[model samples]
Target: MPANIKALKARIRSVDSTMHITKAMELVASSKIKKATARMEESRFYRRVMEEAFADLAKTDSPYSKTTDSDAPRLYIAIAGDRGLAGGYNNNVFKQVKAAYREGDMVLPIGRRAVEYFRHHGAVLYSEDYTSSEKLTSADCAAIGRSVTSAFDEGTIGAVYLVYTEFVNMLTQEARTKQLLPLVPDEGEGEETHTAGTVYEPDAETVLNALIPEYVGGITYCLAAMSFASELAARRQAMDTATKNASDMIDDLNLRYNRARQGAITQEITEIVAGASE
Candidate 1:
C-alpha cells in the first residue's frame, strides 16, 4: 500500500479504538444514571423536610434561630468530582468556589479535585479527610455536619455556604450555591403556624440545637447525591459526543483510503496497457 494510504489506515484504526473506549464509558455512565437519579430524588425529599424543620425553628426566639453576621470568616463547602474528563463538571463547581471565596474564609473540599485545586492555590482547608464525594455516606455527612455546626455555634465561622452542581435533568446541570447557616424564617409566618400542634420534649431551644446538626447533615448528603448524579450525567454526555466524533473521523478516513487505492489501481492498468502496445 502507498504511504499515504497506509497513514490513513492507521488513523482510522486509532480512531476506531478511541471510539470503542468512549462508547464503553458512555454505556457505563448511562447504566449508573438511573440508580443515581433515584438516590438523588430520595435524598431531596429528606433535605426538604430538614429544611422546613429548620425554618420552623427560625421562628422561635432562640439565638440560633436568627441569622447574624459576625466578624468571623465564612465557611464554604465546595463539592467537586474525584475524576476528570466530565466536560466541565468539576470546573463549574470550582469556579463557583473562587467566585464566592474571600480572604481568611475556610473551605471544606469534598472531592479529590477540589482538594488539589484549593491546596495548589493555598486556600485554608477546614478538613482534607473527605477525598471522595461519591463515596461519602450518611455517617460521613453527620460528622461533617457536627464539625461545621460546632464551628458556627462557637462563633469560629460567621456563616456557611454550600457550592455544588444541581441536576435539573439528564441534559441540564447547574452550578449553584445555597446558604446553610443562620436559618431564615419565612416572612409573615405567624409563630402559631409552627407552634400550634407541636410539642417539644425537653424544650424548643434544646430540640432546635440538636436538630441543627441533623438538618445540616441531611442537606449535605442529599446535595452530594444530586451532585454525584450530575457528574455521571455529564460524563455520559461527554463520552457520547466523543464517540460520535470518532465515528465521523473514521468514516472520513475510509473515504480517503478508498480514493487512494482506486487511483493506484487505475495507474497500474494504464502502465500495463502502454507496455502491451509498446
Candidate 2:
C-alpha cells in the first residue's frame, strides 16, 4: 500500500508540472492575439481596396483577364504556423494545398513547418528564403510578390494560389485557398460602372501592371496575418484543454493516494491490536 501511494504521489507531481507549462502557454497565446488580430484587420482593408482597383481592369479587357495556358505549371503560396501543438492548424494548411496540387505544381512555403513538409515530401520549391512565418515582415511578402509576378510575366507559371487559415471566430479557424493571378472578373460586371471622369495617366494596362506586385504583396501579408492569428487562437484552446485534463488527472491521483494511505494506517492499527492480544 505504501509503495502504491508513493507511485501515485510521483504521478501527481508530474501531472502538476505539466499543468503549469500548459497554463503558461495558454496565457502567452492569449496575450499575443490582440496584436495579431489588429494586423489582420489592417491587411484585410488594404486587400479589399486593391481588389476593387483590379476589378476596373476586367471592364477594360486587360490581357491579364485571359485564362492561363493549360500546359503551364501552377504555383502555390502555402502559409502555415511555425510551431506545433496548435491542434490541426498545420495539417489543415497542407491538406488545403495538396487538394489542389497538380503533378507539375511548385510551392513557395511561408512557414517553417510548410517549408519542411513540402521539401521532405519532394515537392518542388520556388525559393527557400522565406522560411519562418513568425519572423515574416511586409518586405518579405513584397519580395515574394515581385518573384511571383515576374514568373507570371515570364510565362513560367500558369496560375498562383494562396493557401491560408481564415480566422472566422474565436472558436472557428478554417483553411482556405484564394486565386492570386489571372484575376477572374464577374460576368455580371459591365463597363458602365467605370467612373465618368477617371482617366489612366499612361494607360490602364500600364497602371494595372504596376499595381499587380503591390496587390500580391499586400494580400499575402494580410492573409499571413490572418493565419497567424488563427494559429494562436488554436494553440490557446489546445493548451487550455490540456491544462484542464492535467488538473483532473492530478485530482484523481490524489484521491487514490489518500485511500491507499488510509488502508495502510488501518492495517497497522489492526496488526498492533493483534500483537497486544497475543
lDDT per residue (tens digit) for residues 78-144 in model 1: 9999988789999999899899889999999998998999999999999999999989899999999
Q: Tens digit of lDDT per residue, candidate 2, span 212-276? A: 88888988998999999999999999999999999999989999898999999999999999999
- Candidate 1 has an lDDT of 0.88
Stretch of 10 with least lDDT, candidate 1: 188-197
Name the top TM-score candidate: 2
Model 2 poorest ten-residue lDDT run: 188-197
Q: Estimate each model's TM-score.
A: 0.90, 0.91
